[model samples]
Target: MTNEEFLSKMQDVLQTEEELKLDTVLDDLAEWDSLSVMATMAFLDKDFGVKTTMKDYKNVKTIGDIAQKAGL
Candidate 1:
């Protein structure tokens, strides 16, 4: 998917009105929580056929990190 589409989808996954960018820090978002992590795992699996576990998120710091995992 295009970067714009990924960002848009992330907005929904994060359940936030704040604009997301590749450089956006996940920890700074109010909606970035355990629930959002599950949503993101589902999003990646459903949309990108990528499998992920909680351990995978340990090193993830930015929105761009997730994008990379999705191969976007």
Candidate 2:
């Protein structure tokens, strides 16, 4: 999927109204909690066939990081 689509869909995964950008830091979002992380894990697996553990999130700092995981 395109980067734009992925970013837009991430709002759903995050359940937030905030506009996300490639450089937007996940930690800066109030919605970027444990649930969001878990949802993101599911989203990646369901949509991109990518697998990620909680441990993987230590390296994920921004929206772009998740996009990379999705191969966007």
Candidate 3:
């Protein structure tokens, strides 16, 4: 997937349209909580067949990490 597609999917998963600035920190997002993490894990698995764990998330500092995992 392309970066735009990844960002769009992230917006859909988070249920937010707040502009996805590349430099934005994931933790700064109001929706970035454990639940959101779980949702993201599911989203990745369902969409990209990439299984991610909470432990794996510790290394994911930004939305870009997620895009990279999705192979964008």
Candidate 4:
């Protein structure tokens, strides 16, 4: 998937159109709590077929990390 596609998917998962800049910190998002993490994990698995755990998320500090994982 492309970075744009990844961002779109993230927006959908996060349920916001609040333009996610690539450098935006995940923690900066109000919706980015544990539930959001689980949602993201599910999104990755369902959409990209990439299984991930909280441990995997520990290394992901930015939206770019998600894009990279999605092979953008």
Candidate 5:
């Protein structure tokens, strides 16, 4: 997917309205919780065929990190 599409999808995954840019910090968003992480995992797996576990989020600091994981 394109970076723009990835960012848009992440907004829905994260349930945030704060204009998610590639550099947006995941931890800074109020919607960035355990549930959001699970949603993200499911989204990535379903849309991009990228499997991820909870532990994988440990190093995820930015939206760009997720885009990388999604191979965007």
Candidate 6:
């Protein structure tokens, strides 16, 4: 998928109205909570066929990181 599509999906995953950029810090997002993590895990698996654990997020600091993981 393209980067724009990935970010659009992330907006849904995050349930946020704010626009997301590649460099947007995960920590800076109000929706960056446990629920969002779980949603993201499911999103990645369902959409990209990628599996991720909580440990994987330790190294993911931005929305771009998740896109990269999704192979975007």
Expressed as tens digits, the lDDT of each residue in 1-72 for candidate 4 is 667777888988887657886788887887777887888899988988989999898888888888778666
lDDT of 3 by residue, 1-72 (tens): 777777877888887768775566898888888888899999999999999999999988899888878776
Whose TM-score is higher: candidate 3's or candidate 5's? 5
Give model 5's TM-score versus the native structure.
0.96
**Across residues 1-72, which tens digit of lDDT does each residue of candidate 5 receive?**
788888998898888889999998988999999999999999999999999999999999999999999988
After superposition, which runs of candidate 1 have C-alpha atoms over 4 Å from their true positions? Answer: none
Give RMSD to native, each candidate: 0.5, 0.5, 1.3, 1.4, 0.6, 0.7
- Look at candidate 5 and give me any clashing residue pairs: none
Q: Residue 9 CA error for candidate 3 (Å)? A: 1.2
18-67: candidate 2 lDDT, tens digit per residue: 99999999999999999999999999999999999999998899999999
Q: Which residue pairs in candidate 2 collide?
A: none
Better of 4 and 5 by lDDT: 5
Rank order by TM-score, top first?
Answer: 1, 2, 5, 6, 3, 4
TM per candidate? 0.98, 0.97, 0.87, 0.85, 0.96, 0.95
State which candidate, 3 or 5, has the greater lDDT.
5
> What is the total number of backbone clashes in candidate 5?
0
Per-residue lDDT of 1-72 in model 6, one digit per residue for the tens? Answer: 788888888999999898999899999999898999999999999998999999999889999999889988
Q: Which has the higher TM-score value, candidate number 2 or candidate number 3?
A: 2
> What do the candidate models score in CA lDDT, each in turn?
0.96, 0.95, 0.83, 0.82, 0.92, 0.92
Q: Residue 66 lDDT in model 2?
A: 95
Candidate 2: where are CA atoms >4 Å away?
A: none
Error of 1 at 16 (Å): 0.8
Residue 53, candidate 6: Cα error in Å is: 0.2
RMSD of model 2 against the true structure: 0.5
Candidate 5 overall lDDT versus native? 0.92
How many clashes (backbone N, Cα, C below 3 Å) per candidate? 0, 0, 0, 0, 0, 0
Identify the runs in model 5 with alpha carbons over 4 angstroms from their true place. none
